[model samples]
Target: MIKTQQLVKNFVSYKKKPGIMGSIESLWKREAVTKNAVERFDLEIPSGQIVGLLGPNGAGKTTLMKMFTGIIVPSSGEVEVLGHKPFDRDKDFRRKIALVMGQKSQLWWDIPAMDSLHLIKAYYEISDADFKERVELMAELLNVEELLHIHVRRLSLGERMKLELMASLLHKPEILFLDEPTIGLDLIAQDAIRDFIKSYHAKYKPTVILTSHYMQDVQALCSRLVLIMGGKKSFDGPIGEFERLLGSDKIVSFNFSSEPSRDFFNAFQPKWSDNGLQVEIAISKEELCPFCAKVLEQFEVSDFQTEKLPIERIMKELMMRPELLNDR
Candidate 1:
């Protein structure tokens, strides 16, 4: 279980002057800018669920994740994880949660990942039998048995990332906060991690909060989403509810061999837009067939394509019109 009530975190940043004289003055009297990374961010995530922590850069996704992991204490309010205050940094609390950041690595770069695992095992005081069983299980789940003995510096980005997951999951934390877990991975590698996360979720049933710019990851794995913007809670609800924001309208596009006359387009009188297609029609989700029939009668259409709003476009639209993200 996890919950945050009026959770707030602010950063004080000093402003430096442009010129050398101004820079010298900045040393004596600093002008600090305060940024509210999270302002009264309220969250309640139950166990055994994956919640997408979605927002653009500087939207407080990473800031919230850090606070949950006990690495950074919130400036105000309460955060309780599994019945313990996270910022207390209790050893018992640390043992029950794991945090993985995309740009940061907990593994030793110069040595084999197994070496790092062993070191963590000693640090956590894991029993020999428990450590061996957990390592073997995690290695198989992550599919990094062969790469375990290889140096992390020599491994590919995907390989190192898989190893990082293995390291994080070794202690079997009850709560996991993954920030951009698949940031740099290609489709193949991303799918692998997605599959692993799914299977791991099914088996372990931990409370998971995953933050990423990649909408595909959220669409693939998270049924529920928690949207943040400008350091505030924008929305928190099912992903399906978010999809319905565009009203399920269908987009039908046609390619023409030549630009038809303005009169020809006027006859059809479709919702005029810049599709480079001489003509573009907006059809209700249920009226695709009739709309296509109406279009084909006039223009010499070479190709036609119909598509629903992509996740990326829906996200962009929501970002532009933040009211669309209002919580249910």
Candidate 2:
């Protein structure tokens, strides 16, 4: 449903010196610099898939989304969404897509969320009956039926976000673009939003491109990930493959009934803490079962578990050493 080839966007901005003297010199002699926000990026997304777009701040994830939505035209290259060039901003193209930014509100602050939803329905020319049906379904899915009459200004951030999501999906767009959909929300609210997104996708199968700093959001909603760093594609694959990219090592954390001697852990070189009562060991994937058995046999174990490396740690590695992606 979406395709791009060597897509690039360059942003030109001026740098000025500090102070009045610098301001005076900036009028005609300002220094201009061009930053490549997206460089030689290529991606293909098929229908009925949710792809997570992930990167650090200033890594161009947002810039790429803007290009896809036609909010800003790319400096060069090609982009097509649902068989129409996004840069053209065709009526049919706009009708088939929706973009939601957590930091920005589409709802009218002084008016009720229901009023804003009605305006969206009218703008999209959805039939009254269809609009009502869609709103009721979304409200139920998001548990926001009571908030619909609340003014946007009075609603909590989470409440307003639910309304924003409802507004975006009312048209039943073929594709949805979510940029930080759960930013600044509490854990409960975040889970609610994630569940709603999952349920909606299950029912509608709309192609979704989600960009969020919250690893939980990506983990809960996306099976595929497209990771970028410095405006270049770093990794693109299934989420499991991305996890394996970090390597075959797993972390084993355990709590013993009592503090173990340093000699007891000498063979494994475990990292111990909490007065040596808690220990964490890193072992190869191949040795996980055998090592677990050894630990259980040798120690009076109270609690034990194995975990893969966290996604946040892998992301840090990717951002610092993007060349690792070249092998992929």
Candidate 3:
């Protein structure tokens, strides 16, 4: 279980003046701009629940995770994980949760992942029998059993990530804090990691807080989500609630049974141009079926399908919108 109240992180940024003379002068008079990575935030994640923490860059997703994991203390407010204050950095708290950042590597570059696992076992004071069992189980689940003997630096990104997961889960923590778990990997690797995560969640039911650039990760693993737009909470609820925010900018597309004159698509803007009268439209909330029927009355409609905008595209659009900077 995890909870936060008005969780906030602020940093004082230094601004440098251009030109040699100005740069020298700036040493004594450095500009201090304050940035709120997370502000007045409140969240509660129940045990055995996987919550996707979604946001664009600088939206405080990582900051929130750091606060939750005791890597960084919140500038204000309180956070608790498994009923213990996270910033206290207690040994029990440390053993109860795991944090994995995509860009950060925890594996020893020149050593075999198995050796690293052994080191971690000693560090955690795990029994030899327990460590061996966990290592083998995690390796099999992640499909990296054969790769364990290979040096980590020689392993592929996917392999390294697999090893990372195996290493992190050695103690079988109750909470998982995954940040961009599938980032910088190919589609095949992404799917493999996603599948492993899904299967793991089903089997172990660990509390998960995942922040990923890949929307598919969220779609596959998280039924609930908390969207961080700018430094504030944009939407907090089930994944459907966050998906609803993209409803206004939905898309409707279909094929035409018969090609009609330009007048068929003249009144409305067509998002697609083709040899036939088939078209797609990126429109706001409107009766898409009736609107499509108006075109269908004159022309035949085939392969009709209505789809909302992709989650990635919608999030990018929302991130650029200034109005979303301080969301409710």
Better of 1 and 3 by TM-score: 3
lDDT of 2 by residue, 20-42 (tens): 99999998898999999999999
Best by TM-score: 2
Whole-model alpha-carbon lDDT for candidate 2:
0.90
Compared with the true structure, what per-residue lDDT tens digits does model 3 show for residues 207-253?
98999988989888898988887778887788766666655545767
The total of clashing pairs for model 2 equals 0
Candidate 3, poorest ten consecutive residues by summed lDDT? 319-328
Task: Write candidate 1's Cα lDDT for 1-328 as tens digits.
Answer: 8899999999999998889998899979999899999999899999888999888889999999988888899999999989989889999999988888778887999999999999989877889999999888878878889999999999988888888888888888898889999989888888888888888889888878899888888988898988889999887889887666566665566777666545544433355446545556555667778757765777677888875435566778778877765543
Candidate with more favorable, higher TM-score: 1 or 2: 2
For all predicted structures, in order, the TM-scores are: 0.86, 0.94, 0.87
Q: Which residue pairs come into collision in candidate 3?
A: 257-300
TM-score of 3: 0.87
Task: State the C-alpha lDDT per candidate.
Answer: 0.83, 0.90, 0.83
* Candidate 1: segments with Cα more than 4 A from true spot: 251-282, 288-309, 321-328
